[model samples]
Target: MIYSGTYTAIKADVPEFFMRKFIKLERIRANRESIQKKLNKKWLTCGIFTCVAAIAMIGSYRYISGIVKVSSNVNGKELPIYCVQTDEKKVALSFDAAWGNDDTQRILDILKEHNVHVTFFMTGGWVESYPDDVKAIYEAGHDLGNHSQNHKNMSQLSDEEKTQELMSVHEKVKELTGVKMQLFRPPYGDYDNAVVLNARENGYYPIQWDVDSLDWKDYGTDSILNTVLNHKALGNGSIILCHNGAKYTADALDALLDGLKEKGYQVVPISQLIYKENYHMDVTGRQIPDAK
Candidate 1:
C-alpha cells in the first residue's frame, strides 16, 4: 500500500526521532551547498582579479622602461646613439655623403686646415662614384661610416634587406680603402629598433645627431653657421649633422669649426667621441657609460 499526503501530514505521521534526524541532515546539506557556492564565486572573482593585475603590471613595466613597438613585426625599443654623456668639452661632426661630391675636396681642405677629424657617412653609390675621395678620407684620418647601399629608409626594410644594405657598403668600403667601417647612419634619419639592433649585431655603432645644422635646407652660409652655433642642444657630447652635398655646408665649414673651437669645444671623429664598451642608452638616445 502507498501513502500519499501533504508534507505536514507526512511529517505528523513520521516518528519524532527519524524526523529530527532527516530535518538535521537536510539543513546540513543546504548549508554545505550554500557555502560551496559562495566559495566558488569568491575563487572565480579572485582569479579574474589576479589575471587583470598581472596584465596591468606588464603594461606598466613596458611603459616605464621605455619599451616601445618599432613595427608590427618587431617589439621593444632599441635606440641609436644620438649623443654621448660626458663632462669633457668634446663633440663630433658628421657629414652624410649620398649625392654630389663637388664640395667634398674643399670641405676636406678646410678640415685639414683646422686639424679636425670628422666622420663621413657615405652611401654605396657615393662610395662607388667617389672611390678616390673614400681613400682620401681614410688617408686623412677621418672616420668612414656606412650610410647604406641605396640610401633607403632603414625602418622600412626587412632584416635580410637591412643586413644587405649595411654589409654591401661595408664590403665595398673595405675592398676600396682597406678600412672596415664601424659606424652607420640611417638614410633620411629614418630608423627603428630593427635598424639599430641590426647595425649593432653586424658590429657597427648606429649614429645620430643631436644638433642639426639645417645645412640641407640651403638657407645660406650664415644661416648654417648660426643654426649650428646657437643650437641649444650643442653641448659637451653633442653630435652635429651636416651633409657633404649641401649647398652651403662647405661654405660654412671653416666658420663653424672656428666658432666651435672658440666656444672651447674639441671636435673629433665619432670613433673618438663614443665609449666602445660598457655603455647603455637612456630614453632620449644619449649613450651613458656604465659606472665601474
Candidate 2:
C-alpha cells in the first residue's frame, strides 16, 4: 500500500524538518551567549572607569584642602597626632628609648637642670632592661608613652599583635611606675591605618614627630643643634624627636634647650601640649581642635 514517492518523501521530510530546527536553535543559543559576553565586558570596563574617576576626584579634593579630618577614623584610614595646632609658642620634646641606659641619667640630669618636662616613649624591652630608669622617668614627672614591646615595625603587625605590643608595654610600665600610659609612638615611626586604629581601640593616642633631630646619625653637636634650631617647621605646636641612645643627643641637649628658650619657645611635655578630645590632624600632622 506504500506509494513510491509520497511515503518515501514524507519519511525523509520528518528527519530533515527536525535537523533544520535543531541547527537553528543551536545558532540562537550561540548568538545569545555571544551577546552576554560582550555585555559583561562592557560593564566591567565601565565599572573600572567609574572607580578610577572616583579615586581621582577624592585625591584632588585632598590636595586642594589638607587631609579631610573625620572622627578617629578617616575614610577607614586613621591618622596620628603629630603636633597640635596652637598659636602658643610651645613645643614638645620626646626621646625614644630602645637601648642603652648610659645617656639616660645624664639626659635626665640635664632636663632637671632646665626644669623641662619631656615625654619619653619607652618599649617593653627597655622597661624590662632598665626598670629603675623607668621608675625614675615616672618619678621625675615626664610623659611616659608606650613604644610597643619589641620595637618591631607596627605597620606589619596583626591586630592582636598590635594590641599585645601596646598592652604588654602598657602593663609593664604601669606595674613598674604605677602610671597608665595613654600615648603611643610606633617603633621607627612606622605605622599604618591598622596601627593607629589598634592604638585607638586600646585607648592610646598615636604620636608622631614634626621636627627630627638627626643626632641618631651621630652627626656631632653642631650638626644636631643646627638641625633642631634652624628647622623651618620649628613653630608653635611642634614635636621634636630624639633618641635616648643617640651619641650626641645628651651633648646637644643643653644647647638645644637654651636655644629654644632664647627663641621664646616654652618647651613642655607632650601631654601638656596635645588636646585629648575634639581634635583633627592636618596633612602636615598638625592636630587642630574642632572648636578652633
Cα-based lDDT for every prediction:
0.90, 0.89
TM-score of each: 0.75, 0.75
Summarize candidate 1's per-residue lDDT along 1-292 as a digit string, tens digits: 1122333565877887877676677678878999999999999999999999999999898765443222112235777888999999999999999999999999999999999999999999999999999999999999999999999999999999999999999999999888889999999989987898899889999899999999999999999999999999999899999999999999999999999999999999999999887677777788887656
TM-score of 1: 0.75
The collision pairs in model 2 are none
The residue-level lDDT of candidate 1 at 44 comes to 100
lDDT of 2 by residue, 155-239 (tens): 8878999999999999999898789899999998998888888898899989999899988899899998999899998889999
Those runs of model 2 whose alpha carbons end farther than 4 Å from true positions after fitting are 1-76
Clashes of each: 0, 0
lDDT of 2: 0.89
